[model samples]
Target: MGKPAPRSFAPSPFRVYNPPMSDANPLTRRESEILDLLAEGLSNDEIAYQLGISPNTVKVHVRNIFEKMEVQSRTEATMEALRRGWIRVPGIEAPQVEASAEPLSWPPLESGWRSWQLLVLLAVFVGVSLFVFWPYRSISVKVAGAPAFTTDSGSAVGVVTPRQDAPRWSQRAAMPTARSRAGGAQIDGRLYVVGEIATGDTAALEMYDPNLDVWQRLPERPVAARGVGAAAVDGKLYAAGGCAGESAITNVDRYNPGAQMWSSVAPLPEARCGLALVALDGRLYALGGWDGGDVTDTLFIFNPEQDRWEEGRRLPEPRAFLGGVSFLGQIYALGGHDGVKQRSEVWVYDPADDAWTPAPSLPESRSGVAAAAEGVSIYAIGGGQGEQPPLHERFDTLTRTWSTIDSPRTGPWRHAVAVVIGPNLYVVGGWGGDYLANNEAYQASHLLFLPLGAQGLQ
Candidate 1:
């Protein structure tokens, strides 16, 4: 490799992304385990005792974590770990760890008073352990098709049911204005519906609060478009390549959920509609869609570091009105249409090799199916050919096989969107018979599941 070109702009110091880290700087499993502890506000001695190791040994692991994560202090390491999904802080919001001129102490405490305090804390923990049940969120698993959880076509689940089948797809509060063909994705803990609404629907950005089972409206996207693609990365939602009136457009709109604001980024090279998008390795990939005149196979990738788009391998077949989801670190383009006919081909793209591979075809030729990945499996939700169905299928990456799962109650639909957050796979607005404002959730049964803030233990 040669010296890289100099940068035109500098990103913020707090920025973290999914760029491939160099293999030359790697951390062992033990080091990653220690970093997880550190993110929980554990000190060196506390981590050492928890893992049945010496304080000095834990200190060595912490040093290695700093070097590999390229962070000089514990706070930086924790934030980086969280951004990278290497660690998760459950039950509580992430603590604000501000930057300081001086790094923190190794164990963070010293001398006799702290030592006696630790001993007293240990005794209290033992007593509490015996009398109170620990949080079971960590050990529970989701059960598919639990009768205990149910939702109607247009109604939302107002209560949380504690049963053997914990994870399920229950309808949430319907959108105030039911519309379809809109772009949707989950950013932060809320689900955002963007893009084109039904002909008379005034609101462009609609948000759903799953916990409260209520709907609230947000500001519309910067650009007015239909047939756009949506994916959330770096905590920002990017809506790219949809139709602007009769012409296909290359315009891109970015919205920050935190600031409730909109901005622009580099647009796609080709102005296209009915595109599919997925976020992998902290980057965005825009796949096949329809130009104003014809369907296209071109693929463009967005690099956040440079805010630029680089063209990649073309799709094996030109597709539009398709669905896509990233599973096991690769993008899978599901069934789609070529202007006139629906397709069953399963095309997978490997970012590492920059190549496309054909996987098993859909059980049946279908288009406009919504997809979401959980663990190693990707579920193709309700979609079909000329006459759509309520049926969806599951594809397992590990086995390279496909199986038909019970269809969602959403019935036949097209242009729907699905996103995975925690254990629930949230499915939102699409054209089901007519434009829909419904939001439904799906979760795998008999699978290990851990949701944020789950209380009580088995």
Candidate 2:
């Protein structure tokens, strides 16, 4: 009868097909095979090749496997499979799917679909709640406070609270030597105090660690000096022009902390003290300072790679002891004395075009202030009227406006040095009338100043 219908190889209808059921009781037999292969770290192509199936078929199987396992990623799927005893190794035996003896059926499609819908709805609900309920958050900071200035009609010298939060001045740590009117530079995170007026003609190099709240003595300068301008390029700290003993110095010295040694490098174009040295755009810019006698308008840039100094655009208003900082790619020269008068003038120098532009002036005219750039704001702290004003001002670069911060705990004076470590600013070694070695750190709420939001909300 037509070759007996070609004797089909299909199993008899009475023969039973028994497939392994997972303890989690959801995945189908084929889906379990696909997941097991996935757990073996085989990609779709490799899985398809091993299974003798098309990559498209593997993809469809993978999607179905994910839905059945309720996992988004392969790692999650593998983890779930292992957790639920859905997989077993060659040597290891598979755990029993269920303690109950009844044969399990696949979970209802409607139930799985409903669970997925519930998850999506929950996610959407949480996201909407977060967006609607938590739009903006408020944070308080301790900043140097605004000074209370009492002007003397002709030439007013006012007492300013130097430390913002506290009424009484507190010392943080003492420097190895008493220093005043020093050059300070921060490299990496270490605060380096280069040259300052100490007991003797001091060349003492002191380093302050903010993390430890301690000071360590570094190798002394090659020549005992003060008023030396320091800047870091790459990893090397360059100490430039200052006075050695009582004489003005042009000699530039380089310090290697790793080696704990010092070496002399190329000298500055002019011997200067009270000048500003800052590293901007990979080059060190040395701004206005005193050249033994007169205040200099001389601006020079040093290239560490070439070990040379090139003339830069000079400050429009010549002044020594000016606070200079590089912010938003521009060098800002703030409050300083021009020999005859204390200046509130703020000037910005752009290296790209080599031009100087006047910025919004400081609220108070003071020189020898400690200027530090934190984010987009520059803080002019504890500067004197000419020598030191008991004044503190903060310049917001974004707003181009100046706001007076609360005064420091110490009296109004300058020659104090400030360096920003993390979110806190440390003011150290300032002079009020006589040279002071006291150190103070502002941390509490009283020292913080919060800026207004776009909507004028604090």
Candidate 3:
């Protein structure tokens, strides 16, 4: 390799987003674990003891963490981690002190004191000490069921019944190619996956048939890119704005299944990747993304009839790798990263008013998530790392609340795409330490299974 050309601007210190940690977070799994311990006021030796590692190794990890996070001390690192939603502190209430009739004071013992008087004095002293300290006993009482470290999505406890409408996931046929940052679109009961971080085939394209549980390759994408945003409209799949190598690109390519050809459309006003593309009312809306150097708040809309991209209202907060979906004639942009931290804020865009409004925030903060709407609910899947793994959250539009849903994978699941077909929500390829070929299907409807004896009786 040759020396690379110099950049026009200085890169951000938090830009080392790659392998093992996904694209948003910068720390490794072990480093993140150590950081969590540091935030809990643990010394290096204590952290080493907890992780079953040498104290010197823990010190080295802490040094690397400091360098990566650009912090000089543990306090700064803890604050940065907390700001990024990388670690959560449980509700640790402080012990309250009560007022006494007299100030805590003691008079010097008189030299003429007798032996009986001295014994009485010692007994009184012991009683006073117990009375003063008794109220603080509850301070050491740990929060029951609270894990040493966990995400905002409260830790799971004793057995609980699953909701009838809760989404349940099951593994299906894996993709032929294992890759991360792939984009997906659902058309005609088939899901089309395009672009990802593969060895030499970033533009790899394949389609999955749910009923048959089979995958077949289609014509590959002409533009080699990952972190692309895709949506199906009018029987055609549109993939737009993703990182082509190290730089973000504005290329908008459309694929016609009937013709089996790819063609270019009007490019975006600016180059960006990790944005969200969703079709609402026959038009494609490109939401927030990262524009090479910084997270973008820009929104662009593409009209097929005009074959041009138009700039729309700026996002309430700039973000990338967010989950966007059209539900009940409105666009909902879910949790995403804003360069520094993962966001839990949910925003709803009204096409009629051309304005964005706040909605109920997600139960947990994440980015690179897959969002799909089924019936009256929207599912936000995966996109977590650090002290936490990717998880699922469901938004009940009718109730205007968010709740946790069951997920198949308990590890990092960022950069995946989701699409709903009938009663099932399918989450496609994403990164989990390494590139994944997982094709997991989540059933949104209630299902019942009969016992073997009951089946024989029937």
Candidate 4:
């Protein structure tokens, strides 16, 4: 017993680490799953889609994983996991050294080379180098918000990078009737456009099928109005207040795609036009707009069950021609015009709290902008003054930050209607210069990672 008490407790220079069990691990089961996906370089939205959860939920898990591992970024967490032998990445093999009794050997070169032979070898090396670098020297990519690229020849030239995750825009079938300031809604994988300018045919309703890449005329609304607010709730499309001719009107209409018909619903309490409408938690929200004389901060909630419009909390400021959408479970109001000038303000309204809180502002003032939500990102496209490049920006709900994306149109694309169907964003006709018949389709940016497992092997 005395000899056992005198035993040494010194550390071992050569030690091995064994990963802990699930119960002893810092992360939970769900967190571990998220960490594995993060190692694959999947974005929050992509991870949420794969897990069949909301992006907000994915974000929460990511934050928890960071806290548990005491790591700041995904790369750090992944490296830490590798160091602890907690996870294994596919297709990464260690170099193998075969055991051998003989000494290492190298190929023997000629004792001496002639000057002509050396010159020939040098010329071959230069040829191979130029051949390898020719393509890269001839190609360049102009990233969004990057400085202008100019060659010494003073000519503009670029090459398209073969990147799957890069944001790109493509042309779609042009609208039959070119118009601006129209109301748009999407239902059952189809986009619906209603009410163009009052000067022309205001009650023009059309439906676009992304699968077919075609547009079909639908039954017109009962009231001929323009600058209306439209949304779809519970599979039914609701079109609200807009201008008929010279003034705003309180006309609410509901369209059923299954029946291909339109029916009148309870109109708004007051007349307004150029408003922003969105559906949240089974109800319709009509945000700020012009009420004939001036811009208003009105927030009207429409109850389909009761068929009534209830006044909710007003906005922080009065604005018209704004962009609004129901992201996560809250209502977001983007930039709009307030009587005299365009605004860069952004506000979020939580239904549970019944209050409006200001979020991050846009990069520049915009009006008549179109906003749509896909996964964890909100796209604000087509607005702002001047003949500058089209202002196409994306807002990350998880990070609460905004970033610019590429746009097809070089000039302004205001008063356009945008809808997200599948992975493509369909932007219908708008007033780019005169009435534009442009049907620009934009593919949202995805974060492409190094393919893992079998894909990596392929």
Candidate 5:
């Protein structure tokens, strides 16, 4: 038999006194404990571990502490805690200041030397101002452009030789066929887009020549697929693992810009579509893909030397249509549709230890984002819930902050990808309202705008 239920009782309600101009019962006992930990410089995760609580719970408590304390951040909360006598240092001393405290005073100096001292101080101030405010201009680099190409809801193609001082956009040559969900990469000196599945013809490999303002139809892809992922290694282009007909395919194909030929490499171990490919060092990493049934976080690593695929660590969440880029020899995966809704998680993979770390998350939730990483900054451009405004965000590895860039004339582009060469980025075809033939190039300082010199399109 089960134990009998206990009876509940009502107690008298008592008012908890608080300081003037403060909330009654300033903070709860748990919040006070959290504030004490904050004063000790404990992070949310660290506090969670010490208190044997979930990190999410710790986060909630910390947030509550800030509210009751009328503080913005941990530092502010610690300062307030000290003021309220909620926390104290063991050895160090802190002097409290009143709201209406007077400023410090200095004794008067002798009148004789005061004027001379004032003159000397004025001269020093002028010299310092001159040194700090010297006027000079930065030389802007020249970016050569041909005709511009744009997708639907975007501008028409033209030349975009923008001033390095300010961002500018120009149209470029459009694709012969308007399609979306194509995979693109930079190999040699040209941009290649594989599998235009929107036309129901998933066998095309299209090449764009930025210097010549032209589009050339290369040989068709070996497999009929769309939303395939492509990567470049040693000037060679690779396309693999995409949606074919009713399901994802496992075929991997390699294209030689020098030989103008296509060859089949080892296929992927699993079938996946809407996946992303990133090349680091000499190896390629395939991350988070969709396989009709549900999204997956499976990661695959391919070794060119061995010509085979090896499994790697899985993602923290199941997602697809996300963006992946290799930067500083590390792989970063960001923003995807987790089958239910859009995700903003940013997961980083370090090949050295083969472990994953959480960097800063994306500013907003999105999917079908195209990504490109050069040096320390990674760019996530286009892609949203459906078609909205053109959104571009840059993540700086050094500062770990995300900054928004000027939007493209094109409004709401999805199923597109970006490739870096030198300081320029070519964002190719995607579905906006219809199959888009638009291809636009972004030119900014220190951007990966490497030209396809000897590897120029034939």
Candidate 6:
């Protein structure tokens, strides 16, 4: 073979383009230069001119400097650099300063022009931070094309939004009375509230008409009770199992809104106070409560059609002063006291299978909280820590995780009750030591949670 033909020079497929290396560390060169310029009190424009670069480029470099230094602002950057041996005062002769240089000046850059630029950049940063870190707040919501009645601090507050200089709704109506430990149910567009007080139990039953913004007292409960468990089924409000005369009672009553009358129903198998009741499918399920003196583990199911009560699977652990809500056809029981200790354990009951399963645990142990389901999520609102600590917690049923919420309006009470109408959740009736009548409502500030494969609206 006449001397194998010289192979033509071919670039290797695996070779990557390699740029020419500069004398200094390219990753940090721009940052170092920017810091030096900043220490010399040179304006970005002046620094740009001295470095023969665009002011925008200088800005990018300064930003990199700030980030690499893990600082918030130019002042913070300077302080950090001085502390980290990255920069120094002129007279100090530090390792970073190789030659004599003027002392660094305040604000770093020229007064009028550079100050404006810095201010503009700062304003931009602040705006971005606000948009990123600020807590989202729900503005307005409508259900069935009508504004729902929302309660705040035991008062009826309406949503007010200006439309063409006209006030949409800006009036506050008085609540019947401050109620804590109260249970509420909505029937035929009317909201009914029952029982909640530590002492001098209230048989007072009140109904609210959202369209008229008026509250009227309905027929009083047949038996005076507090911490009562309640549910609405077939247009009738069922009140059952509450504390009466310093003892838990199994007295159950049903109220007919159309007739404005009350009738006794089959009492729950167990007398419980601070129990949670939810209407699911056509039956009512009662879970978690104090029976006489201690928390009970029994779960009771009431069939309104049959006028009977049946025992369902018991809770994994006995708990009382708890909060429960029906979400995605399942009953979720959140934090509550287990008689001897506070618990963060959350349990879910599936009626379809008649079984109880463990779900996510709460971030903190608490009891006497209130819960309500809106859309696909259940929110556990303010409650006392165990039989003590006054704090508030919230949980997303879809995500099965607990998060602390900013609840400046959380009352000192522990056994509060909650109900959801539209996008608002109202917490009512609780007791710290004394009976708390404070009624507070919280608006879901984030998007309504929709669980994966959820079939119903959340």
lDDT at residue 133 of model 5 (Cα atoms): 22
> Which candidate's TM-score is highest?
3
**Per-candidate RMSD vs. true structure?**
23.6, 27.8, 19.2, 24.1, 24.9, 25.4
Cα lDDT, model 1, residue 358: 93
lDDT per residue for candidate 6 within 127-193, as digits (tens), equals 6534532211111111121111111112211111111211111222334444556777878766688
Ranking by lDDT: 3, 4, 5, 1, 2, 6
Model 5 residue 364 CA deviation (Å) reads: 1.1
Q: Rate the local accuracy (lDDT) of all candidates.
A: 0.66, 0.65, 0.71, 0.71, 0.68, 0.63
Native-vs-model 4 lDDT?
0.71
Candidate 4 residue lDDT tens string, 307-389: 99999999999998899988889999999988778899999999898899999999998788899987778989977654534
Model with the higher lDDT, candidate 4 or 6: 4
Tell me the lDDT of model 1 at 302.
Answer: 94
* Clash count, one per candidate: 4, 23, 0, 0, 22, 7
Q: In what order do the candidates fall by TM-score, top score first?
A: 3, 4, 5, 1, 2, 6
Between candidates 1 and 5, name the one with more favorable lDDT: 5
Worst 10 residues of 5 by lDDT: 134-143
lDDT of 5 by residue, 325-423 (tens): 988778899888887888889999999988999989888888878998755678898777544565788887888999988755546676786887655
Model 1 misplaced stretches (Cα beyond 4 Å): 1-168, 200-203, 445-458
Model 4, runs deviating above 4 Å: 1-167, 197-201, 386-389, 445-458
TM-score of 1: 0.60
Residue 33 of model 3, lDDT score: 77
lDDT of 2 by residue, 1-458 (tens): 11111111112111111234533467666666677655543445445545656656977888887787678766577556655656533323443565577867767758666777779967975565335322110001111121111111112212223334553334576554445567777777878887654232457788888777677778878876656677777777788877554456788888888888999878888887777888897998999877766777989998888989999888897777788888879898988777776788999999998999999988877777688877667888877653344777677778988876656554656767787765566778755533445567644223334566322111
lDDT tens per residue, model 3, 1-458: 33223212112112111233432677888898787655543444345545767656987898899889888776577657655556543331223346578866545556577778989977975566345432222112222332211111112211111112333668787676655567888999999999763232267788999989888878878898877889999999999988765578999999999998999999988998888999998999999888877888988999999998888888999988899999889999999888888888999999888899999998888887889887678889888654357778888888898888876765566767789876678987765644456678887744234346332110
